[model samples]
Target: MTEKMLQQYKVWDAPTRIFHWVNFTTVILLLLVGTLMYFKKDLGITGLEAKIAIKEIHVWIGYVFAINLSIRLLWGFIGNQYARWSNILPGKSFPAVLSSYIASIKSGEPQQFLGHNPLGRLAVTLMMLILITLAITGLVRAGTDIYYPPLGASFAAHIAAEGVDPASIKPYDKTGTNPEAYQELKAFKGPFGDIHIYVAYTLLAIILLHIIAVVRAEITEGGGLVSAMFSGRKTLAKKPEDLN
Candidate 1:
């Protein structure tokens, strides 16, 4: 009987690995803080002052989330082959790859990929988009009332929606501003907030599914994916055709 030969291939680069871990931790923080803010009353905050204190923590971390996402997106363009956008975004080869992967699924020998598989690529893309939307909406809400930076300057515009009274509610900025100017900017917080929430739930669902898929893949496919994020290498059986 022939023995299997394992080959270690360098996959995720250092930047990608760091981003994975930092984003993973940051996302957990954002979710926890966000949930707390959502149920501030139940959490026994007696006053808006106490409520805003917790919100401040969430907003600060959100800044970190925004920066992390921006860098990750930029890295996608210049990072290693495995971390590049070309791999994450299904291009012309995607159709063939999808069909091929789907077919291979039934064979009980999942198709091997040094980088993200097609479905994995799709999931990554969706998550990135969701993250961007969440960041924007979160900032807009801050602008709407909390008046955090990056979006604070635009708070007036985001403060009011169509046919809504801008003065009806107090501006979070609290600096000096023209009531007329604040009133003129179109505000669509209601719609944007809904998208932020619905997409957040969707992201949560995808993340859980991602975890399950990774564990299943590692067990059944013999890929060291879980450790790859930490060590940036994958050990696979060397094909004889590649042997000299």
Candidate 2:
């Protein structure tokens, strides 16, 4: 009987690993805080102060989420070969590549890659789009709903009463705000809130599927995927399909 020969590969870099863990932690916290806010009334939580406090916490977590996402996005442009957008994104040859990968999977000898496999690339692309949507919509809600920064002052100034300072406008308070303009601002922000929440629901499903896929790949492919994110290395028995 022949013994299996395994090879270790350097995969994830330090910045990539840091971004992954930070993004994961922030996403979990945002989900929990968002759930509390969504079901605050059902949980017997009441009063304006309590409601705003929860929202504040959620927004703070979202800030962390947004910053982490931004760093990762920027890193994709300048990071290592495995971390670059060229590796993560599907290109003109992606269809053929994906077909080949699927065929390999069916043959009982799944092809392995140091970076994302074709299917994994598709999943990551979809998730990145969803996350960017979440960040934009969340920021819009933060500004329109709570007078937070970036777009807050503009929205506040737009709705403020004549002779009133935009900075003096308190969230949820009608004073120092023109009624008609306030209503208009509310209408404008409504769709963003709707999209933010529904997309968040979709994200939950994707996250579940992502975890399942990772676990399945780890078991069937013997890549040490979970550990690789921490230790920045992958051990595989065969030569990786994406090895360069």
Candidate 3:
């Protein structure tokens, strides 16, 4: 048997690597805290103080997540060729490319891409959309539920009783708030809360699938798929399809 030759390619950039780990860390933290908050009662966690405290932690973590995501969004415009949206997101010719990639996979010759492969492009786009949804809904809930900033002051003012200081209003407490307006605010936030939670579950499912797909690609394709997120490089045995 002839010796196999492997090539090293600089793929992910520094900002991309940083964003990946930061996003991953913040996501895991948010999920852990969010899960606890969701099952607080069952977990024997009680009282308004505890609930607010947990939510505060979650919201803070969410702030980090949001900032990281925003930076990544901007980076997509100015980062390296592989990290740019032009390469990662599906363009006009995506369907044919996806079809070809799938056919290649079935024929036992999966195409290696320095950036994302066709299916990966789809997955990343879906994942980004989900993450953006989560960020918006989470912010809305942070404002409506615990009276956190960005939307909190406005929500508080909207629900405050006549002549009552919005600043004086407390979260989860109806005191100093107009009963009718408070009820309206609650109704308004209901759908956002629902979407936030359901989409969170969907994200979890997608993350699991993402992990599985990465592992499979690593094993069958001989690329350091997981390590690339950290080292910002990929090792491939064959020529990369998207390499320029």
Best TM-score among the predictions, by candidate number? 2
Overlapping backbone residue pairs in candidate 1 total 3
Q: Which parts of model 3 are misplaced by more than 4 Å?
A: none
Pitting candidate 2 against candidate 3, the one with the higher TM-score is: 2
TM-score (C-alpha, index-matched) for candidate 3: 0.98
Residue-wise lDDT of candidate 1 within 101-167, one digit each (tens)? 8787778767778887777888898889889899888887666556567665556444455565444
Kindly report which residue pairs in candidate 3 clash with one another: none
Off by over 4 Å in 1: 156-187, 238-244
Q: What do the candidate models score in CA lDDT, each in turn?
A: 0.77, 0.93, 0.93
* Model 2: residue 57 alpha-carbon error in angstroms: 0.6
C-alpha RMSD of each candidate structure in angstroms: 4.7, 0.7, 0.9
Tell me the tens digit of each residue's lDDT in model 3 across 1-244.
9786899999999999999999999999998999999999999999999999999999999999999999999999999999999998898999999999999889998999999888889989999999999999999999998889789999999999999999999989999999999999999999999999999989999999999988888887768989998899899888898877
Clash tally for model 3: 0
Tens digit per residue, CA lDDT, model 2, 1-244: 9787999999999999999999899888988889898999999999998988888889988998999999999999999999999998999999999999899889989998899989899999999999999999999999998988778999999999999999999888999999999999989999999999999999999999999999988998888999999999999998998887
TM-score against truth, every candidate: 0.85, 0.98, 0.98
